[model samples]
Target: MLNKSEISFSFVFSIIVMAELICGSVESLSTYHYFTKPSILISLIFFFWKHAQHLDAKTKWLTLLALLFSLLGDVFLMFVNASANYFISGLLAFLLAHIMYVLVFLRKKKNSKKVLPFTALLLIYAATLFYFLKAGLGDLLIPVIVYMGIILLMAITAFLRQGNVTKNSFILVFLGALFFITSDSLLALNKFYEPLPFSNISIMLTYSIAQLFIVFGLLKQS
Candidate 1:
C-alpha cells in the first residue's frame, strides 16, 4: 500500500500535470510543455520506483520499460510538427509501449472467461474507426492499420483481465485502455482528418489520465 508520503507526492505531481496542461491550452503559455510533460513522466516513474521493492523483478522491469518508451513517445511527438519522421518515431515508441502493457496484462490474466466479449468489442471499435479514417489515411494506410491492430489488441487484453483480478484493478486498467483509445482517436482525427477545437487540451488530458489510471491500477495490485 502507498504510504502518506507517496500518496502526497503523487497527488502533487498530478496537480502539476493538470496545471501544465491547462496552461498549455492557452496561447501564450505553450512554453509550459518543457516542464509539464517531463514532470508527468517523472511522476509515473517515481510512483513505480517507490513501489518497486514490493514487485517481482520481472514485473518491475517490464513496467519501467513500458514507461520509458512512453516517455520517449512524449518526446518524439513534441517535435512531430517539425518533421514527419518524429511522428512516425513517436508512433513506433507508443506501439512498443502498448506491446509491453499487453505482455504485462497477459501475465496477470488468470481467467479466460471474458476474452470473447472483449475481443468482439475491440473488433467493432477498430473496424468503425478504420472505416472512417481509411480515406484520409492514404499514405499512412499500412502504418495506421498496424497501429490500430496493436492498440485494439491491447484493449482486448486489458478487458480479459476482468474476472481474473480484483474488480477495482480490472476496472481501472480497462478504463485506462479505453481512454487511451479515445486519446489516440482524437489525435489521429485532428491530425489526419479535421482539427477539433482545443484538441491539445483534450488529447493531453485523456492521455495523462489514461497513464495515471493504468499506473495506479498496477500499483494497487501490489
Candidate 2:
C-alpha cells in the first residue's frame, strides 16, 4: 500500500479534477464526466484501505462494500438525462449501500432505549418529506418510500452507535449519516419536487463530505 502522504496527494488530485469537471463546465471530453463523477468515491475507498488495515473484519468489509455500491450509484446517476432507468439503477445501488452501512453499524450494537427516540425523530422527518414528494413521485412512489425507509434506518443505526464506539468515531459517523440524508433529500427534492439553484454542486458537495466523515470516523475506530 502507498504511504498516507501519497494517497492523500492522489485523492486531492482526483477531487480537483472532479471539481473542474463539474464547476468549470468543461465540455472538451465527452467521457470525462463518466470518470470524474465517481472519482471521489474511488479515492475515498483507497483512503479507507490505507487507514483501516486493523479495523474489525466485519466493519471493514461491510463499509468497503458500502462505498463500492455508492460509487456505482454515482456512476449510474450521471446519465440521468439519457434515460430514467439510470436514475432507478442509481437508487438501487444506494439502497444497497445503505443496507451495507446498516449492517456494519449493527455489528457493535448496544442495548439503549435512547436510540428509540431517534427512530421517532427520523420517522417524522421522512414522513414530512414524503408528504411533499408523494404527488410527484408517480410510479416511483413505492420505490421512493422504500428507499426513504432504508436510509432512515441507516441513520438510526448510526445514532445507535453513540454509546458503542469512541466519541470521535461515534460523533463523526453520526454526523456523516445526517449529511448523507441531507444530500439525498436534496437530490430527491430537486428531481421530484422542484429545481434548486446549484443543485449539482450542492448535492455533490454534501455527498462528498458525508462519505469523508464516515470513512474518517471508521478509521478512528481502527
Candidate 3:
C-alpha cells in the first residue's frame, strides 16, 4: 500500500495527465490548426519530472529517453507545414520513442512467448502502407512504414509484458496503446484520403482514452 504522500503524488500526476488529455482533445476538435507538439512535449517532460524520484532507475532512464524522443517527434511534426523532411524527422523520432517503450516493457518481461500475431499485424500495416504509397503520400511511405514497424513491436512487447504485470495495470496500458493507435490511424487516413464525418471528434475521443489509460497504468505501477 502507498503512504499518504505517495497517494497524493499519484493523484496529482493523474490530474496533470488528465489535463493533458483534455487539452489534446480540445486541440484536435477545434481544428485550431495549430500544432500540439509543444504542449505534448511539455506534458511528457513534466510527467517524467514529477515522478523522477519515485521511478526505478531503469524506468526513469527509459521514460526520460521516451520523452526526449517524443519532443523531437513533436518538433518534427511541426515542420509538416513547412517541409517534407520535417515530417520524416517526426516519424523517425516517434519510431525511436516506440523502440524505447519496447525496451522498457521488455525489461519487465524477459521471456518471449507470443510474437506471431504481432508479425501479422505488422504485415497488414505494411500492406496498407503500400496501398497508399502513390496516393499523394509518395514521400511519406518510408517514414510511415518504419514508424508502423516500431509501433507494432511496442504493441507486442506491451502485450507480453501484460502477463507479468498486475491485471488492472496490464489492461490499462494495453487498451491505452490500442486507443493511441486508433487515433493515429484515423489522423493518417484523414491526411492521405478524404475526410470522414466526425473525424475530428473521433480523433479527440480516442486520444483522450489513450492518455487516460497510459496515465492510470503508470500511476498504478508507481
Candidate 4:
C-alpha cells in the first residue's frame, strides 16, 4: 500500500493528467497542452528521481533521461502545426526516450522463450499499422519504421523482465509497455491515417496512465 506522501503525490499528478486530457480533448483548449503536457513528464521525472536514488547510477540516469526526452517530445509536438520539422523533432525525441527505456529494461534481465512470441506479435502489429500508414508517411517512411521498431523492442525488453524481477514489477512494466503501445498506435493512426474520433482524449488518457504505470513499476523495485 502507498504511504501518505505517495498517495498525495499520485493525487496531484492525477489532477494534472485529467486537466491535460480535458484541455487536449477540446479543439479550442488544445494549445494548453503546452503547459499541461510537460507538467505530466515533469512530475514523473521528480517522482522518479526521488524514489530512484537507491538505484545504480546507470539505471537511474537512463530512466531520468527517458523522461526528459519525453518532455522534449511533448514540447516539440505542440509546435507541429508550425512545421513538419517540429513533428520530426518530436519523433526523434520520443525515439530517444524509447531507446532509453529499452536500455533500462535490459538491466539484469533474464533470457526467456516468451521473447519470441511477444516479439512476433509486436512485429505483426507494427507491420499492419505500417501498411495503412505507408502511403501517408511520405518522407517520414524510414523514421516512422525505425521509431516503431524501437518502441516494439522496448516492449519486448519490458516483458523479458519476467523471471528476473518481482512478479509485480514484471506485470506493471509489461502492462505499461502495452499501454504505451496503445497510446502511440492511436496517435499514429489518427495523425497519419484517418483521424480517430476523440483521438486526443484517447491518446492522452492512455499515455498519462502509461507513464504512471512505468514509473510505479520502477518504484516497486525499491
| CA lDDT for candidate 4 | 0.88
Q: Backbone clashes per model, in order?
A: 0, 0, 0, 0
The candidate scoring highest on lDDT is: 4
Q: What would the TM-scores of all predictions be?
A: 0.92, 0.89, 0.72, 0.95
Candidate 3 — which residues are off by over 4 angstroms? 1-37, 110-115, 118-122, 125-134, 197-201
Stretches of model 1 off by over 4 angstroms after superposition:
1-7
Superior by TM-score: candidate 3 or candidate 4: 4
- Misplaced by over 4 Å in model 4 are 1-4, 27-31
lDDT ranking, high to low: 4, 2, 1, 3
Candidate 2 per-residue lDDT over residues 49-79, each given as its tens digit? 8768788888899999999999999889988
Candidate 3 local lDDT, residue 129? 54
Residue-pair clashes, model 2: 0
Residue 110's lDDT within candidate 1 is 65
Order the candidate numbers by TM-score, best to worst. 4, 1, 2, 3
Cα lDDT of model 3 by residue, 1-222, tens digit: 344645565576556544544554565542432444355456646755665676688876786687678677766765577987787787778777778777877766646546676667757875785575448567676677677667777777767765677777677777877786777778677777667677755765675456556545654554
| Model 1 CA lDDT for position 52 | 68
